[model samples]
Target: MPTASGSRARGASDEEPLRPAFDGPLARRPAALVARLRQRAVPSHWSSWSGVVSFGCLLVLVVTGLLLALLYDPSGALVRYGGSYSLLRGVEMSRAFASTLHLSFDVSGGLLLRQAHHWAALVLPASLILQLATTFFTGAFRRPRQWSWVLLVGVLGLALVSGWSGYALPDDTLSGTGLRIVQGVTLGLPLVGTGLSWLLFGGELPGTVIPRLYVLHLAAPVLLVLLVVARARSALRHGPVQFPGPGRTEDDVVGFPAWPTAAVRAAGLLVSTVGLLVLMGATLVVSPVWRYGPSSPGHAFAGSQPDWYTAFLDGALRLVPPGWEVVWLGRTWTLAVLVPLAVIGTSSLVLASYPFLESRVTGDRRDHRLLDRPRDVPTRTALGVAGVTVYVVLWAAGSADLVATQFRVSFEGVIWTLRAALLVGPLVAGLVTRQVCATLRAADRDRVDHGVESGRILRSPDGGYEEPRDALGAAQRWTLTRAAAPAARPSPPGSGADARRG
Candidate 1:
């Protein structure tokens, strides 16, 4: 062999040298992680930020929630509040409510963190809704990404239930009233309703419900985190969906690397989200339990309203006409509650199975890497618009009482109008949205086939005036032409004879 230094130099030049395993104490792990991250494929900018923001918000929520949980009590035992608030200095209240007040008014930095937690909870659902709508309108839930959509819906449902349970944990008059309504609705089901109510409340109303709800609220987030991880992993495996453009293909991914570029972008977003949450927490007052007294069975809460997420159900309850209950064999069947419950349940079921339903209807089972323009899929886009219209109308109807009081209109009139809108609005929206989609599709076809009008008058050979036309670029042409083509249905396996005949 040559001299040791010469041999080492030759090896470094001729072949790749091995990376140092232990540069310093505990250095290998970080270096390896950085290398791995650098190779990770990430989606384009617009599609990546929603998930980053959602993750950041959820992290903040978890940290703040865990800290707050250490100071919370879910029991119904009596206690006296002697905190900073002068109004409730010596008032006797339930332990749950008293602890909530103490957390809000007594502990250092507790109030700010608690409010931030609440804001994060609200942001979580909003982010999920935006992400869901993006996926739905972009047709990203097809083929390899089916599980991603299912996981997202599951996470959203769990998040809503967790928020509802957290709301009930305060044990204030408002929350207590909401809990009572929940109990009543749970008990109003036909067959398994009574058993389900018993399972929830133990024996009857107010039977060890708070502790159970507390456990659920705590556990729900962990499950959501797991589901989110699964969703992300599936996306990584299947690769991100793309829009048709130049130098783009179904087999190749075109985007930024995950290490320095994407990671830095996510880090910036995390910092900004935390800063915004802090600013909001420091100023905004949410769920002021002090204003509402402790839970009292004898008192009735006037103007009782659920949170915005639960308002649709509240609106449904409000819009239902009274005296719709039927009593049979010592059991009561409340049509007002049961019918709404049925409608919501059916809607949720349809929503969860929508990807499969769409696939069967369209007979398109091919793996799609490019997204279809909304106008290309007119019927599906129209259905999405109609669904959103129905949801918004119902959400507005939930605030019927407030609307009536503010506008000096009859509450009955508002309810009746909302009921009619709830029925007619979706139908009209579907029709209008379908027409708009068709119009857009037609315009796209015209632009792709013939050039767009340039608004310049040109003299023809016969002395007639005509407008000049501008040709579309390659990328625009590709987007519209590819989308205009009908989806290719996948052939069944073992169809070689049929293929040959064709």
Candidate 2:
């Protein structure tokens, strides 16, 4: 052999240098993964962004809520407030109210954070409602997505509870009135009403309800996050539902990729949402507890109204006729409370089970990956509109007092009008919406059968005026022609298909 050092160098050169993991195939693997992620298609439609907006609001709520929770005192004990605001100075109030006043006046950025939390709470429910509507109109709840719909409805219910609990945490006059209403509603339950009320309040009206609510309020978010994550994962597993278009099939997805396109858009949306909430907080004053003094069972502020999300329940209660109570089984039954409870509960049950109901009626069990245009399903569209009309009527009824005062109208007259609307509005809306949907579907079919009018008038050889038409593009034509065909009614038992199969 040559020299030992020369032999070692030769061996190393011949075997090739040992490469580190970061420099080997693994190095290119991450890049390849990133590239693949960048190319993964995401739905870019405006309607697809509603869930993102809701999630953005939820994030804002969590952040601001945590910040506020650090300084909040959720106690119902009596305390004397001697804060910066002169109006409520030396006033006897709950610890909750005193801390609220202190946060508003003493702590830096506390009020802004509190208002941001409030605004985010308001926006979260609205966004969830919008998302639910979009899902309903598009038939996204069909087949495998039915569970997702149920999850979304559950999330919405949790949000409503969380908002109501947070609203009560301030222990102000308005919120106190809301809590009293809750206590009454709880106590209105049949047989077990008193026990339930005691369990909830821990004894009496303001006993330990605030502490109980605080626990519930915190627990709601945790459950919400878990449900949301589950919903998101389910959506990813099922893939996104896309609108009908050329080159798009039930099995195909067409949109921008997830990495840069969706990532950038979502980031932009989150920033914009946060900025808007902050601006609202800085400029608008919401729930001024100082003006309301503090919680007291005997006192309630005039013109007080619950937040919009809970307004329907308030309106429902207001709309019930007086003396709607009955004696049954040697106990009193308050139909005023029971009626609204039954109506709202039944409506929610119907809504949550609608997908299955439609499936059974239609008898079409195929997986639906492409969304149905609202016009393609006239009856469903009409039903959704009708339900919305009912909700709007209820929501408006909640502000009946304000409407009466503002317009110099009769309070009873407003109540009566809303009551009538509660009965008649949905029917009218359903009929009109169905007609409109039918008309739109007809127009779409016409557009498909006949090319679009080009508005170009020309003189024919015989000197008659003629208008040229332009053919629709492949995507436009497909969109117009892809409406769901009407389902054939089932043949009578043992009549046609069943007999043939038999």
TM-score of each: 0.88, 0.90
Per-residue alpha-carbon lDDT of candidate 2 for residues 197-295, written as tens digits (9 for 90 to 100): 988788888899888889989999999999999999998788778776554556656677777777799889888988898899999999888878799
Best by lDDT: 2
Let me know the TM-score candidate 1 reaches against the reference structure: 0.88
lDDT tens digits by residue: candidate 1, 1-502: 5455235643447666677766774786786778766666555638557877788778888999999999999887778877788888898877888888889888989899888988888888888888888888889899978878989999889889988988888888888888888888888788888888888777665677778888889899989889989998998778777665544446544556677877788899889988888788899998888888887766658777888888888887877888799998888789999888878889888888899999999887888776767777778888999999878887888889889998999999999999998899999999998999889989998998898989999999999998988998766776676677644322222211111100
**What local lDDT score does residue 261 receive in model 1, on the 0 to 100 scale?**
77
> Could you report the Cα RMSD, in angstroms, for every candidate shown?
6.6, 8.5
Q: In model 2, how many backbone clashes occur? A: 0
